[model samples]
Target: MTFRECQRCGTCCEKGGPALHEADLGLLEHIPMSDVVCLRRGEMAFDPRTQSLQPLSAELMKIRGKDRGWECIYFLSQAKTCSIYSHRPLECRSLFCADTAAVLEAMAVPTLSRQDMVPQESALWDCITDHENNFPVGQALRLAKAETDFAGSICSELDDLIRREIHFRQVLADRVQAADRDLWAYLGRPLWLVLLPLNPIFSRYEHA
Candidate 1:
């Protein structure tokens, strides 16, 4: 049987929050920065088309998951309703599991990046840029692979980088009086957590 309208089963919402696109810019005011996280370029993330984790070609802002899990933060699971149905992101509005043509086409369009979300001249934007350049996930993942499979001598360097990542965010937070949630929203997740999937060794540095 073909379904004509949404069943509100929450299947799509449970998979993960939709990636923000240009059309969703107007809705940003309704969505708090603390609820967003930039999936930086080169970071490995779930690719719906491929059904596997693939490195993102470009940075895209996504609604952070509930309690760091993949469930869309705005999804009201028990009630089976959207917290912001009136003005959900473009991907959300476009998605239809039965026929994903609309959603796939929406994915082809340019996504909203960190620069698009924040003013280019602001200190906050500068800090985000610096963090991306200085602590890139690709470089960290490469270092982790080397440590796990090769010389293992680079452990110290990787450890140092992890510590620097913590300090970098700490100093920026103190200077700007930014809260931890805001810091995560602006700079993406911590390096240690991001690297955890690549290597279990990084788990020890989680609290560092």
Candidate 2:
């Protein structure tokens, strides 16, 4: 089928929300921070353009999905239309499933980060920075990919780290008075959830 325009089929929105770009900064006035999520750098996320998982080159702040699923929060499932159609992010406006050139080009552009969303002088920013340093995702990835478990120590250590991280996230949320819906955006997804992409390997280690 030859496609020339968007049919508002909800295919794109159903897949996932778009990452915000510099041009979409102004749209933040209407979009709540709770509706966004920060994919930390070095984290493995599904790249729609490549249709596979890849480590992010930089931090990416994107809209959170609905009910913890990939469907865009703004998508009205029954109507198959975007609630914020008029003020959608740049990536949303550039999407054309039939001719993805525009969307692919848009993906190449730099994305907005959590740092950009919070004021540098704010105390919450300090917490964010401290959290990033205390639980560097890159370090966790290295440990997970290490050549040997050595008496299952690596897995043991990782299990502990995961537990500590969970506690830390809760503490941070309390300190910032952030709701559960907003915690993912404020601190990134849980370490265990992020490690899910490693699959049977991580699972094996967990059980070992």
Candidate 3:
């Protein structure tokens, strides 16, 4: 098989910005929060074991990118360059879709330790903390629980917590923008998405 060399075509960026790695924490303050988003515990993730996108049991901070289209936020479609190319995440630099070995090896690299993050003394950060703590990834079975039962009136407590987080992210999103806003964007999605609970993370590292 002839291996194709990368041509900087931005197709990978369409898969979304690289997940934040431990090495990429340094770029946090340099990049606008408008360009980042956190993946909470309850959100679905692919379980290599099950070959399914199951909800994880912990929080993960990642760069915000296009939802349905898979475009990285920093990717400039017009010019075909990353707006933050010089400081792109480690995965962004190491990933080479055409190179199977490289792609497999890169998968083992861990994302930025949430422990490395120094929470700012602000309401937004507090809100984020609240969201993670309130609707924790306490049960992997949450993925299997009928949504109507897990996060519905049957679980009004969780439902209310989810609503608060939605409002929190929406209100905070308006505050952070590309206009030199220092914090990461707090773009919350639908309420149902917010209510899924996660199991504990596989790692031993303490999170912020």
In candidate 2, stretches whose alpha carbon ends up further than 4 angstroms from where it belongs are: 146-154, 200-208
Two-way TM-score contest, 1 vs 2, winner: 1
Better of 2 and 3 by TM-score: 2
| Candidate 3, 32-57: lDDT as tens digits | 65567656556665443365777656
Kindly indicate the candidate among 2 and 3 with the higher lDDT.
Answer: 2
Which regions in candidate 1 have their CA more than 4 angstroms from the true location? 149-154
Cα TM-score per model: 0.91, 0.86, 0.65
Residue-pair clashes per candidate: 0, 0, 10
Please give, for residues 102-129, the per-residue lDDT of candidate 2 as tens digits. Answer: 9889988877887777888998788788
Over 4 Å off, model 3 = 46-52, 67-69, 120-126, 137-145, 148-159, 167-208
Error of 3 at 143 (Å): 8.8
Error of 2 at 142 (Å): 3.0
Q: Which candidate leads in lDDT?
A: 1
Candidate 1 C-alpha lDDT tens digits along 148-201: 554333477777888898899889878888865576668888888888776566
What is the lDDT of every predicted structure here? 0.83, 0.80, 0.56
Angstrom error at residue 95, model 1? 0.8
